[model samples]
Structure formats: C-alpha cells, structure tokens
Target: MKTSLKRFFAGVAAAAMAVGGLALGATSAQAAGPVASTQTGSLTVKAANGTTGHTLKAYLVAAYNSDYQAASDGSLNFDTFKYVVTKDNGTKSNDESAVKAALTDAGVKASASGSASSAAEEGLRQLTGQSAGTPFGYTDGTATASAAERKFADALAKKLTATDSTKWTPSNVQDLTPGDGKFTADLNPEGLYLVVDTYAQKDGSKSTQSVPMLVGTKFANAAITTQPAGVGEVDMKNVTVPVHKEVVTDNTGKAANNTPSYNIGDTVYFHLSTTIPDYSGYAADPTLSDPTGKTIRQLNLDDEFEAGKFTGTKVVSVKDATTAIGDQQGVLENGKDYDVTGEDTDTVTVDLKRLVNGADGAKTGWKTGDVIDVIVSGVLSADATTTDKANTDAADKTGADSNGNSNKVTLNYSNNPKDNSQQNKVPGDTVNVYSFNLNVHKVNQDNNPLGGAEFKIVDKADEATPLQFTVSGSTYTHAKKDTDGAIETLKSGADGSIAVKGLKAGTYVVTETKAPAGFFQGALPSYTVTIAEHYTNDKTNTTRTSTKSGDDWLDTLTYSNTPDNYGLVTKDATSPSTWTVKNVKSITQLPKTGAAGIAFFSVIGVAVVALAALFAVRARKASRLA
Candidate 1:
C-alpha cells in the first residue's frame, strides 16, 4: 500500500478492476431500448482464498453502451467501449452530470461537445487504457491493465464513492455464502459496478473483510488468468488487521521481547502495537463534519493483565510512528488524540479512532500503514506466583494455571468500510513477566524439622550485599534495599521452612546466619540457588530486522550446598525446589561432678602438701644463716 493519499488506492483499485480477462460472457443480445435488459450477465465474486462471512454489495456506477459484437473465437469485440448515464439500481436516479464532472476533475478525459454516451465512453476508455476505434483486448485474452490504468481506476472509484454514494440502495446487496468455495451473484443488468464488502462482528468472530473493488460485468465470460480463476469472477482480496503485545525493554521502541522475566516489586514495561488499515473507499461523514474521507468509527487497543499479579497500571505514552515523510513520530495527547479508559486498572483501553479520523480538532494527515504504539507501565505485585513450567502457547491467557503474569492486548477496529459502527475484535499474542520462588528447610541429621533458624539471601552478582525483605513473624516477603520495614534476617517457622518469594532469574545464595539454639554453629549451612530462564529466537538473521519472530522461554533451576559432604541434606522434587538443610550437635557438654572429679581433687591435695613442706624448710635455713 502506498503511504501517500494520492497513491493510496492505486494498487487496490487496479487489482480489483483490472480483470486480466476475468469478465463474464453475455449470452443474449442487447435489447433495443433505453436500458438493455437482455445484456444482463451473472457475475460471481469468488473469494479465491475461500474466505467466508462477508457481505458483498455492488453499486451500478454506469450502464455499458450496447455496441459489442460476438466473435467466432468465444469473445466480444468492440471498437468503442463506453458507459452511459442510466438509472442506478440503488437510487433510481439518472442525473450523471455530477459523476462526469467528478471524473473530469480527477484527470479523466471526456468530450465536451459530444453526446452524453460518447463522453462517458471516452472517460472510461481513458480510465481503462482502451482507445476509441480499437478493438478491446478480448480476442487474444492476454490483456492486463497497466499502472496508469490502475491509478485512474482508483481515482474513478474514489470520486464515485464520495460524490454519488447515495445512489446505492438495498437492491444491490448480495449475501456471499458458501457455494462450492465460491459466491455467485444472480444475473442482473450488466454494467460497471463498485464492489464493497462488510462483515458483522459476533462472538469469536474471525471477521476478514475485502477491500473495495470495481468490477465490470458487461465484458463477462473472460476467464481469470490469476491464481484464483473462474468465469466472470474476480478474486476478493481479504485483509485482517493484526495486533501484537510485547515487552518494551528500552526507550527506542525497537527493542522488544516476547519472553521476559521480572522480579516482584519491579515495574514492567508493556507495548501494544498495530498498523493502520487501508481506508480508501471510506467517505467523509457530513454528520460528523469530517473533512477527510478516511475517517473510521473506532480503533481501540484494550490491554488486560492478570489483575492479581499486576498493579498500578500507568500509560506511559501513545505514539503514531512515522506521521509523514521525514517525520519519525507524532506523539498523541492523552484525553484528546486518544482517551485511555480504565487507566490504573486491570484493563487499560486506548481509543485511537480520534487520531485515526482526526476527530475533535486533532491534527490530521496521518496515512495508512502507520504504526500505532501504546506503551504502558505496571508494577509486578509482591503476591505474584511462580510458574512451574513455561507457557508454550503465547495466546493462552490461563496464567494462573499455566505460567507467569500474563499481559494480553486485544485490538478492535471498524470492519465495515461503508458502516463504521461495526467493529471486529482481534486478540494479539500475550507476553509474560515471570518470577521464581525459593523454599528453604532446616532439619537435623535425622531429617526432622528443626525450627528457629535465621537465614539471608543475596544475589550472586553482588554477593557482598544481602537482599532486604520484610519479616512478618516467620514469613518473609521480598523487598527493596532500604525499604521501610525491611529486615535482613528471615526466620524459619516451626515446620523448618522459609519461603522467599518474587525472585528474578539469576543465581542466589541462601545462608543460615543463626542456627538453632543447640545445633552446631560452626560453618552454618549455605546453599546456592540459581533461577535462570533462557530464550532462543528462531530468526535466521542475527541482526534482528523484522518483528515477525518467535522464541521459547526455557526455565531452569540449579542448587548446590557449601560443604561437599553433608549428612541427609538434599533437594526435594517440587516446583520452586526445596533445599533441606541439616545441622549437627556441638561436642561441649560432658560429665561435671562425678567419681572422676573426686579422684582429681585427691591428687591435687597431695602435691600441694609436698610443695608447702619444702618451702617451710628453705625459709628456716635462711633465718639461721642471718
């Protein structure tokens, strides 16, 4: 699709109207009357892709002149291919002066002094690249419309839709249904018709709609040479607006992750994205005072998160990327360009229709294919649960039973170009923020529960500093450093279990700072717990250019104790694996007062008596000499 308004509808209209010999054959001759009822042909708008569930409506823009001659080789030859003003099947009006003037204004050529039929033929010839006094390319059946032909077709379709749209009524509607994987409309008066599709939104709707196309049924029976081919049939190209949800890791909005992990009490950045739909045939509504003919009724992005796991949802920014040539972005204003309802709640809805249609005095000139991004921030709750296994399906919303905290985004946009009131809902892939928990158990050599053990946890990256936590009796909750009411020690309960929750993906060291009263305090048991989640991007290109990529989050757990040899100390088979720490008794208590003590006292008394006698004799000898 072209980014500019002038070339926006060029390819779409050209592809739709450029039959490439895909028109129907007229079996009957033209009737001699103002309206040729015999020239009617059965036209089928076959969805080559076999897509169902769309309403195809055709409006007769003009009536073809009855001047074609059937050739011998099953083809119609015409020196002049022209469409004249006739009563529209919709409004029953024949005032085609406005239509001709619109064609002329769009650079289509028509005769000023010729008959109305001749002037209409000349304009159509210029639009279809068919020249007067030349046979239409039906004999060889290898003719294709050129780029110039397509450009003019787009202009003609747009003008007719904008200037004379009221001419279409209920009589020209066709409910395209399942008929051998194709839809064939009933035989009607053959002429130049504008085809537009509409889909009704329902529960679990896969509403795929078709772009506006122009089909000429007057030249029927030309077999289609495209991939989807049939007699008098044109392929209906359907489009589905896509929506994506990702984790924004940086400010550039280019770095995104589908598989992400975060710690509890940490703020997670979320990004919701989708491109603008093609709005070629949509006309301005006079009721809304809309000047741009590309106004849509609604374009919304509703983001839903696990309410129990996420809190304080904040919309950071909403940007319209690549507003124009050389312009990188156009930041939309809150409550104006887009209104965010249910902000700070579990579900945040961003309404982008105002910016899409330039409603309420907002700036216009935003083109199709523009990327709309809604960036939001939310804090992971301290009560978030750890996932035992990674979620393989990104579309699954069962976060509580399957994986981690899930953030999902759903896009709702106008499905019907003619009627903007109807909308289709498309849910994007869900991205998750994961965290893990570590369970520690204190026990004796017998593997019995031993209580009163205090422990602390520190990240391996910075083992010098212990992670802070808020202690409540025996329970410990993860907290930030210097946080109010944060403590350094987490005491074990009577069950000898200490649960440390909301841990990020990294190696952590859990050491027992205070052992039980009588347990050996020498070399308190310490275990290293590593929680890592690895992701592999399936993209072949290492440079990371496109957004269409996939990855899988491989969650892993590793644990090891400080001492190489420990009695009955092991990890249990459980999610958030439990490490049972064992303690031994101190060898200090022995007999205090017994028979051994009495014997020791007797020996000491005898040695003291001998020493005293020797001292007395030495003192008497010294006195005599003096």
Candidate 2:
C-alpha cells in the first residue's frame, strides 16, 4: 500500500495482475471487474504539530452490495442480499456456481481464494461483519449474507485468524500522510466503502491511543450514495462557530425584546449556532490508529439552555453554511439522533448523537462548515418584574433581568487533542427589557428644598383614583389598587423627594394636596407628569431628551412648590445641568390705596346702611317736588 511513485511506475506490468487494482496510469473505468475507482478523504485536526496527544488515523471498509436493513427501533440489520457482481459488459451474476463458471470462461482468476488475493478477501469480510457467530454478526434473521458473502467472510477471517508470521506479512495499513495540517487520499470506488478517522497527540510516539475512543459501527461511515464515476470531488469549507451571538429583537404586541426593559410573559426570539470540527487529516495520527491506544468514536454536541426565563418549546435546525440560502437537511427528531434524557424546569440538555444510515449502512459525521441554529422561543417569567439586576453570573438561572439574559451554549467533543476530550463555548449577548422608576423632587423658586409637601398621583386624563401604598421600613408598597378611592397622599422626604418605583410608560398627574407651612391655599397647582420614552441630554438636567434609540430616557421628575403654584424644575436652556424653575413672585402691597381704594371704602361703611339712607332722602325730596 506504501508503494512509491518510482516503484509503482517500474512494476506497472506486474502490478496489473491485481484483480481489484488497475494499472498505475489507468484512467478509464474497467469493463471486466468492478474497479476500485476510489477517491480518498483525510480526517485532520487543527492543533499545531508537535502538540501533545493530537495524533490521527483512518480506517476504511467497503459496504459493497450490502444494503443496511433498519429495524423498527432504528437499529440496523442487513437484509439478505445475493452476491451479485456487475461485470464491465453490464452482465450480472448472483448464482455462486454460475458466477464461478462465467469468470473461468472469461479467462480470469474469478475465485478470490488465491494466496495473493488473501488480503483483499480478508479485508472485504471484515467490512461485511458478522451476526450469528459474533456480537457484530451481519445476519440476524433481519439481515443475513448470501453464500458468496459467506465465502468472502471466510477469506477475510484468514487475516484476523492467521498466525503472527503468516498474517499477510504485516499488521498495519498505510495511513494518510500529513500535509500542512491536512491529508488526502484517492480511493478507488470498486465497491461501496466506509471511511473512519481518529487522532492523538503526535509527539513522535510510535504508539499512543487517541482520546474518547474512535471505534465506530461498520455501517456508520459507509459511502452515502452509489459512488460517482470519474475522479470524486470532496470539498471542505473552513468555518468556525461565530462567538458573538447576535439577537435582534422582533417583538410582538407589547412584548419587549430589548435588554433590561422587558415585560413579564413576553416571548423572546433567540437563536444560536455552532461549527463542526474539521476531520481532514485525522488518519495520520498514530494515537488513533494504534491498536493499543484509545481511539475516537463519535463527535457530539452538548448544549444547555437557561431554564428560568426561556420557557416552552424550542426549535433546532442543522444547516449547511456553504450555500447562500442555507441549504438545510431534514429536521432531526428527538430520541432519534438526539435525546433530552434528563431535562427539568431549570435545565435542558440535548446531546447530538452518532448514528448509522439505515439505507446505505454509512456511518454519520457532521458535514464540514455545517452549523446548528437553535430557535429558543423563550418567555420571561413573572420573576422578570423584580428590579434586581439580572442573575447573569449565576450559572443556574436562565431568566431575563435588568442586566439582560444570555444563553450559555457549549460544545463538547473528542479527538482534537488526542489524549483527552476538548470543548469550546460561545456566549450569546444578553437581551434586556427593563421597567422605570420615578423620584418626585419638591423645591422652591430659589431652588431651595422644601419638605412637608403632600401630593396625589392619578391617571391625568381619566382622573382615576391614585394608587394607595402602605409603608414598610423604607419602602412604600402598593396597597389598595382600585379606580375610585381617595387619592393616596405621598409625602416628600426630608430632602423633598418622593421615590416611586415600578412604573411603565404613560402620562400621570401630581397635585400638591398640602404645601409647606406658609403657602396661600396650603396647596400648589397640579401639573402633568409625562413619563414616556423621552431621552435625557444630561442626568442632572430635568428637561427630557428626544434624541435617538439607545439614548438616555427620563430619569428624575423634579417638582417645585410656591405660594400659589407648582411646576417642574428644568435645566437652563443654555446650560444642560443648571436646574431652573419659573413661578410668579408674591409680596405685600397697599390695596388700591389711591382713588379706587377711597371710593370702595365710601361705598362700604358696613356702609351699605349709609348708602340706603341717602337713597331714602333723595326719594322723599323728589316726591315733594312732584
């Protein structure tokens, strides 16, 4: 198998005697016997050379003429198939006696019982596998081999059962050679074949086992389809699982998908994806191929989603990334290729499994550059209503909070490091949906803080009753939440500020029911307090900002009280942070102390009596004159 180019060329005439092999330069398809028109592919690792325990090896077996018979439970059984070999002239023979006579008449070594054909015959039987006589027996009533296959199996057993000195002269098969972190093979597609690969830490050890076990079922890596004629094409695209999880929100109804401001019970549309390990040059590693060391068996993905906030069912898809439109294979069924074996309310884990093809008996490996996208249709729980920062650091909770929520997606696999298992994880960005808080500040025209002020908040347009709150330590919680009660009073703190928590976007009204000690009506005027999504130019500036998305919204809602009026304090138009408020000034003044004052006094006189007497005198004189 390790013949050099020179030796291959020099002995072309002699090597042509091989029943399955063709001339070194032969390019055309054979007509007499099934040509090993094989094209090879290598399993490679990305780790650097001389790295510890990162070695690789490959195993190949042909599944020719043997159809994989599947069971009701998705298990495999090969249905009985006749040993029919297609000739170059399109003539096929299934009868063992007829096949022997035909090959003899054609002047060829039809029977593979020859000493030189021993290796091939042995290799073929190993590929067919067993059933009745061994644990991996091929025929189990559901799947059994024909007479020709039995003979083939007997021939292959020679290699496995042959004595140490007579085991066809060697115990090793030439592995794919390494080239720039990759390996290549040109396989002759004579009969259907399977390719399996493994790796180990290649630090010059002639023998070492690859980690996590690479022993796989014979049917697992078989050729997927009937091999195509001409040179086979194998394209491997290099792509990694993108680490930056981008979650753009498309909220419905009043749902909030943005970070730190979400409403409870809202659905968040989240998606995460991952990459398949490149198994390009794995065959060359001795650790994986060494009959004495551990070998790679299968590649699996371990992804667990947070359970606290992401609730309900989920959607997962396997996609081929090489195409622009994202060509997708059929959706995988749960308990088929994956299982949620031990899942609960707070944790869910899906393990991608390795399975065999029921049709071709080909074992499965992930396609290169292929990624899996999981559509997590998660809903925020009632716990989202809390004002506490998100439990982002908690490895247990999966709920969305003020700090946002992220999915800790992880990938667990084997063979890349050869000696032990390895893993790589990518974190999705947090989605934040947050509520608002209000701080009502009371001040005077001079910007002086004044306490002892009382106010009532109501739905301005509807004049609905203000919500009531009961005091508990430093907290004032909502008490009676009806629509027609007396407006609950809110008193300013010593600093003239009243903190209102847990509010949403809408318009509210704050009416001063009682003012500080010396106010005119002992009350200040009412003003509309709009708490919508208005951006803020500066934190200290009371005026709202209206810039763009992502800009600061309304924060502090400051109010000022005076003798007969009350209004909000705003930042100076020229200076963003300078607080300012406007109200009419009141001072002592002499009442119309001029002509208007004198006339008003003359007419008065407790003075309605004087006016009535004058009117009576004038009436008597007028009557006498008449």
Candidate 3:
C-alpha cells in the first residue's frame, strides 16, 4: 500500500516542477520498498548575497507520502496520492479522527474509505503545487496573478490565520545575518511547506525584500532531478527600483548636473527618474482612490524645494523613456494613472497606483525595467536668499553654509510584494543652484571715497541685453524685465559702495557710466568679474565635505577680479568683492592775464631773432662756397 502511495504522487510532483517548483522525492536507494514512517529530509534556501539579513519562517502545508519521479526528458511528475495534515501542536497525530477533522476545517473532505472526492483532491493539488519561483501564480508568461490564483491564495491565507492560529504555526524559523547568504531547515517529515520572509523591509537602503517561496523538504536523486539531491534548495530572487534626480541642462533632460547656477527669475529645469521593477507578485485593489485599502500597493515620488525660492512649479511631463511604445502612450496619465498632490507648492507628490495596475480596467503600457522620467521646472524667484562672503567662494569661512537655492527628491516604493501596506523610502541626491553678487566702490587716486558715481553691468555671454535691476538708495538688486527696454544705472553710496545682487555664476562686465561731480573721469578699464563653483577630490580648499548623514561631495567657490592692480576689497574686512574706481579733481586755476601774457610774447620774439640770424649765416656761407 505504501509503495502504491509513493507511485500515486510521482505524477503530481512532476506537474509542480514543470512550473518552476522543486519536487519532493525519496533520498534512499530503497525506492521500491514501502516508505517508513520515520522518513525525514532537509531543505536549504539560497538567496542573493546582500539579501540575507532577515527572518525566515516555514510552515508545513501538507505531508506527502511518497517520492517524485523524473522522465527521460528531465521533467518531474507525481502520481495520485493522499496527504495528511499534522496536528496543530507541531506533532504527527496520525489518528484518523483527528486527520479527518483537520481536513474538514481546511475545506477538504476526507473519507473513512481512504478516498477523497475529485473536487477536494483538485483543491489540495493546487496548494501543494505552489512554486518558489512563481509565487502567486506569476510565471514568466503571465504579467500578474489570474483571478483564480488570487482567490485561492487569499482563501488559504484566511484559513491558516483564523482563530486557530496554532494550526499553521511555523515548523522551523531562522534569523539570517549579513553575509550568511543561506538558511536551512532540517529534520522535517516528507511534506510540502510554505516559506515566508517575516523581516522583508528595504527602508532607506540598498537591500530589497523577497517574496514568499514554496519548498519541498523531501529531496530527489541527483541523477534523476536537476535540483540538489537530499537538500531542496531554491534561489531567492528580488527586484529593486532605484531613483535619481538632477538639475538638467535643458528641457530634454539628457544631461545631468547636481550643482547648477541660475539668475534670479531664470527657469531652472529639473529631472527625476527611476526604473519600474517587476510588479507581478503585487496585488491590486478594487478601490483605486483608497491607498490604505487592504489590497492596494503604492509607489510614489515626493519632491520638495527650498521654501519661497522657487515659483511657477510645473510638471512638464512624465513618460517611460525605455521603449518607444511606452513613450507614445505616456505610461502613466495624469488624473487617471497618478494624482499630483501639492502642485505649485514647495512640496509635490506623484502617487502611482493605477500605473502598475490598470485604471478603469484599462491596461497600462508600463512594464518591468521601464525607465520612467518626470520633468519639472520652476523660476528662481527673487525671494531666494543671497550671501556675501568675506572672500569670494569662501562659504565655509564667514558666510551662510550655502549661498545657493536647493531642492531634493525621494522615491517611496512598495518594497515587499506580499505586504501592500508597507513601503520603503530611498532618497535621491540633493541638487543646488548658485547665484552671486558684484560690489563696486568709487574712490580717488588718494583712495578717498567719492559718492554719486553711476555704472551698468552686463553678462559677457549676452552683451546686447543689459541686466535689469531695482535700486534702493545706491544698492542694486536684480529684477526680471517684462520688456526689453533700457535698465536703470546704479550709483555709488556715500561710502563709495554699489552692490549688484542676484546674478548667476558667469563672467560679467562692469562699466562706469558717470563720474562723481567736479572730478575728472578716470580711465576705468572694463572690470571683469567671474563667479563659479568647482568640485575637487582634495581636502584642502574644499568648502563642503561629507556629512554624517551620508552626503559626500567636495566643492569650492571661486570669485575673482581681473587686472589685479586695484585689487578686490572686502567690506567690513569680510564680504562682497568690491572693485575700487579711482578719480582725480579737475584743474581750475587759469594763468594770470598781464604777467603771464607778456612773458609768453617775449619768449616768441627771442625765438624769431635767433631764427633770422641762423638763416643769414647759412646764406653768407653758401655765397662764399660758390
């Protein structure tokens, strides 16, 4: 009878292996004998290197009575067989009455005649066929779980976790550590088991979670089966979706730069991107609007800017740049596939639920490995904070920590496919935009301060267009021009200082348009000022370095003035590069009328007599020679 039982399950085990599951088979060479009740085996699980730090639990779902057989084509098969449920107290209670009651509780009918109905046996077969590779009926050919598979899995979970929780207690549990890489469950009776990752949370880190796996404790022969003999080993698989953000060079978002500069009121383009991982194991909800629903899974992108520093926030487009088909369909549609909350505000969020599952039963063009891009733009408003350093680009020495506007973006994704309510957040790198100021001072050759000098500044890149500024007394602040009209000239203050604020990093030409009253206009060369930020690996001359929270980048600030003769002046010994323009007083004392005029005429008459004597001498010398 035991030999017949083993032969009956050979076909069933083969079916399971056909769809990526390992089949349970006898390890002993005595394959033709009646199976012993003391038969036992071991199961081993191997996962990716970095994914091993977690807790794994195994629960016995059914007890198989026989080994699996492999065909000549290397396919597994199990014969028709009967499986018994173990006692809830983690022991083998083979009593017929108790077995019948447990089977009844699991919606399976058991007969005293030792034969189950066809319907009941089919239901049990589905449970035993669960595979480690295709959890939730998600196979390589299927994009998601079918309706029948979802119903069966959900029903099984509810039954296993009912008031009788002990009925499904884990048979073995292991807490794996980093670099361990594998887990083993030994001394298990011949049975099919379900293994689950209890600590599958990938929060703010690179490690991703694994889905539930099914393993058979009883192993097959090495020659007959492809899997490892005596140890049913399965490789745990996972998929991760990492995100990246940057201030790009243009609206196309092809170029990436973490540190960029912009003039006040200039449009700054931002690019946010991430790849879509496999969502076949994830469950979909009936109510798309309810994120907290029992079955809804979520993946969102949250972005924030420095308060009041940006305006006209616009989500230019969100598309899947991986394939041309995805680009044509816009993978995720606004108001249908995702909802943009907090638009035009400092904080904006893109909620992506319907993008994975279809919206209104419509399929999405998105698929695994699709590269998603979110393009956004905003104007660098005048509300941005400005700084003046004791020295140019010395933000670390005596000024605010950052003299630039900044924004950050992060990805909130469904890390665990089994648990829809759980999420893990991974932050992208922070991006910065820098602007600078140019200071001018009017002085005399004696270095005395002279007020009421006027000047205009223009960017060397676009000389035809003069920069507009709003003046408060003698201070100049950059203002966006509505029309291409002439801009106002800025004058020096009583302290011989004029500051032009809110300019982007570039070379600028400063020209003096008017001189101080009653002073001869000094020949002032076109002063060249350059403002820029540079990155380096060296420790010396670095303005910003790594932080305790994992921000590690080296950079320095550079502000310089050409024609180092007058040199840059630091106001109050520290702040703003001030260029000093020197002037001289005009001559006013005229020559006296009588004395000066008579002296001038007497000198001319002396010069005329000397010329006549020279000419007569030359003529007499020529006649003698002739």
Candidate 4:
C-alpha cells in the first residue's frame, strides 16, 4: 500500500486513462486527465466529540497538478460532484453480459453476480483493451478502457469499491484516533480526492463520518472562503443539503388561535423555523441567567420569500426554542437585536453575533433540537401561486381551480465556526406558505346560473362591512382588513357565478346586497357560512375553531329564505351544494291588483248606464207634460 508521494502524483504518463465519454464527461479538458503538482496541506476529519478519521482514505478523483489558485476551478469542485451524481448515469449491470462474454472469450473466470467479481473485472479489461489485471484503484497512466466504458460509468461501480486502491502520497497518510478530530495529511500539487472518514471500531468494523472540504494551498490563516475551521470542517463545498424549514400560522398549540387559511382582507400570521447547528464539544452554562456556549463563534441566517406574496411592511417576532407561551418573555426585538434588511421586507438577515456567542453561558446560544422561530406578519397578496417562484397570471387564477397559493422561502446560514461570509454558508431547504380558496355561484329556482346578482361577504353574521375583493389573473382575491386598497364587492359574474377566494375557515355572512335585475328579491335570506380550515391537532379541535388538517368541514353556513311574491318557494339539490329557489304559485286569495282590482271598473260602467236611463225618463216625462 506504500506509494511514493512524488511518483504516484508525478507519474503523469503512468496513470491509467480515464473514462473518456461518460463519467469522465464529454468535456475535452476532463478527458485530458489530471494536472499533477507537489504542494501539500493538512486535512482533518472533525466529529462532535473529536473522533479520529480511523480508516478514512482520500482517493484522488482529479488533479490539476499545479500551484493552488484561490478561486481557480479545482478539479474536485462542486461541478465534478454534480456531474458524477446527476449526469454520468450508468449501471454496472448494463455491461455485465458483455463483460462476462469478453472474459469468457479471453479464457478468464469471472462473474458479475458475485460468484467471482474478478471475472467481471477481467472481462471489462478485455473489452476495454486494458491489461488483463489492471488494479481497480487509481494507477499510473498505463491502463486503458474502451470508449464504450464511458457510456456505462455505473458498470464500474463494483470495480470502484474497496479503499485499498487509493492513490495517496506516503507522507499524507496519518493515523487517526478518537477525541482527535484533526489529522494532518500532505497532498500532491493540484488534484481532487474523495476523502471519507472510516472509523474502525474495536469490533474490527468501520463506519463513515461527515466532514467538510477545505481548499487551502499553504494551510496558512484561512486560505479559501469555504472553511468550517479545523473544527467545523466537514462535507463538500457549494453542495449543501438543505433541511427544509416549516411554515406554520401558529405553533403556539392553539393558544394563539392562528388560522392557516386567510380571508381576502385578513392579515396572515406566518411562522418560520430553522434548526440550529449541532456541535458536540459544548458545555451548558449551569446558571439559568447566562446563555449556553458552543464551539461556534459567528452565526448568520438569511431568510427570503417571494416579493409580492408578502406585504412590503412586516411585523416580525424572533424567538429561540427556549420560550414557552406562559412565560411569553423570549421575544427578541428586530433591528435593535438583529440587523434586518430587504427592500420589500420579504427577506431578513439575523446577525447572531451576540446571540450564538458562547462567551455568556448556557443562556442564549443554539444547540441540537433548538430552533430559531421567525414570525412574520404579512398580508397575503392578490398575486399568489403555490410555487411562489413567480406570480400567477390574472387569467390563471380560479377559485376552485386555484392551485394552493404559497410563499417561497429559503434559508442560507453560516456553516463554518468563524467564517460567516456567503462563501462559507450552507443552504437550507425552501419552505412554502400554503393557503386555499372557495368558489361561489348564484342560481335560480331551476338551479340555473343568472347574472346581475350582487352579494356581500362579512366575517360577522350582520354582513356589516362588505368584504373587499379584487381579481388577479382571473381569480378573485380578498385582502386583509387594514389594507389600504378598496375592498371587493360581490356581484354575480357574467355566468351568474362569483367566488370569495383566499378565505380562512370561519363563519361568514353572504348577504344579497343587491338582487338580480328583473327578479324580485326572493324571500331567501342571506346565507351564513362558517368555515374553519387550518392545521389543527385532533385533540385540540375543541379548543380551536379549525378542522383537522385535510378535513373539509368548514363552519356550517345557514341561509334564510322566504317565498317570493309569486308563491312559496322550496329547495332542491342543484349542485353538490347549490341553492335553487323553486316557486309554486297557487293563490287562494285574489291579489289586491288582480280580480278585485277590476270590480271598480264594473261599478263605474253600471253607474253610467243608470244615469243614461234616468236622463231618458226625465226627458220623456218632460215631453209628455209639454
């Protein structure tokens, strides 16, 4: 296993040819092979309690073989990992038959099914035009694989197993021990190597560990930007695994009665949470007055959301996991405590210079399971979509059709012990703010839609102030109560249908603010809708107003109706939930303007005839007397 530091690295011509087309990539630069050098730096595996790297071996994946440049694209950069993970998609099984055939043709005994792995290797070499038994690990540029091997990079997955084939310089290999997180290793010039910490247990088994990658030339004071410190250094660069944050209206367990759904004119309360870094070498300050201290120095977290989805003005509350509702004392003030910035106020940066500082005690620092909660008070806007990456077009917004509107939020925080620059930060997962919608339709006795019907929606049963609504991307959206814009008035659409969207579950009154033209206002009274829709725990249903998450039961709605002037009206099922007014006119008493209304005309006619007869008789009598 001993390798010459100069020969293994300097053996430019001795190393085997790389996969030209696939895993090696179609890029000519990658195909050209590693650029070797003689520079070396100290690499260490850092663990919570300072566990040694044990059996971890650093496999040289690529090499520039030159002096290390600060910003130069190192062969082992993030892009290389991406290519290996995403692009060089090939399965070792693909070439299994071909390899076995080639091995059989070459009179070699091997099997891809595990009977004899060497059989598959020999077959690969035979097909790829390499020496019969070219070692599976990185060797001097001597072995060669066929162009087809690049197409099936994953076919070599079996060959790439085992750490014995590592191409480490003799000087860089160091023995790792527990409680000794740091191990110094000298590396050759410009080359990229995959260093895995294989911790060997007393039982003779090995385990892998997580550690950061440090790219420094001389190993002086903080050479490159992405440093987790010797203490915080673990894992790859620019390639971060984000732990998605949670967006909840209320995490107070219903003591706050936060509703997940928002009315058009209701201010939405959003709470965001991100986990704290877990560094094991820390002591909890025994005194409750002091804060907890850890290995971290400067902590910075930048949270961002879609611009228009949230109002420009925000009332933000910050608190750590240490607070309880009864105490209600852990609320930290913004600006005075943390430097908050972002033109639209959709983004906030919390500078935890003093917060995460371990100097104070066990009182104010972060730890495992400890969360930093950021409560942002913003009104859901007219232009909202589930994937807040972009705004929805007005034509695309529909009440029932509205895909759940959401706010896009991301978290980028410092990963290094001391380095707080953007370069040294790890990106957390994106959290989504979700809200639902409701569609409404106005129908006749036949349950057919009619236009010109005006209605009003109010949180209270009185239907006092008409809920203001606006249309965006063809969808009707309501705003919060305190919003400055004009609220939307409900009027039947061209198709005799209207929707009150972006509404949280609550009881609301739908009043016939204005009846449709050509139709007398039906005796049907206003419809009272009670909708309670939000995330609720099953047991907390009694204490809260909302239904369980995924429960469709909004508050019950009651509508009052009276017979129209024509007759008594009855209800029939028009839609799953439609109100159709059926009028059965069978009048027992004549209307004031009906048959009784003409009786006066009949009397007038009789009076006119009687008067004519009297005139005639008087005339006759006068003539006779004359």
lDDT of each: 0.58, 0.35, 0.56, 0.38
Q: For model 2, how does the per-residue alpha-carbon lDDT over 363-428 read when each residue is reduced to its tens digit?
A: 244353455444444555433342322233444323233333334444443333232233333233
Task: Give the per-residue lDDT of model 4 (tens digit) for 1-626.
Answer: 12222111111111211212122322332333323444444444433333422444554333332422333522222222111111012222323343343345434453432323234432332223132122111122111222232212212222334254421122222332334445445554323334434332232211222322212222222334542222212322111222233334443422233234555444555445555543221222222133322223334566555656666535366666554312345555454334466635776666544454433322342434455666655556666542211123433221122233344334544332222331224344333344444445665555566666666667674445666767543345776555665555666766656655565545666556555665544333354554433232223112223543211112222233333333322333443223342211112221224333354345567889999999999999999999
Q: What TM-score would every model get versus the actual structure?
A: 0.68, 0.39, 0.68, 0.42
Give a tens-digit lDDT track for model 1, residues 1-626: 21221122222122223323322221122112234333665566666544556667665555555564444544444322334445545344433554455456546666644445435434554454332111111111111222333334444444545645533232334443447656666545556555667566655554456655555553543432231122245556444666776676754456765456677778888777787765443433323454442344567889998877878887888887767422335887886677888877899899876666656755566766678877888888877766545555654232222456777788887766555656678777665677777788878767789899888889889999998877676667677775689888888889888877777777788888888998767546566776656654433312134663322243443444443122324676664357887776742221123432344455567779989999999999999999
What TM-score number comes out for model 2?
0.39
TM-score, model 1 to reference: 0.68
TM-score of model 4 vs. true structure: 0.42
Best-to-worst ranking by TM-score: 3, 1, 4, 2
Cα displacement (angstroms), candidate 2, residue 616, comes to 17
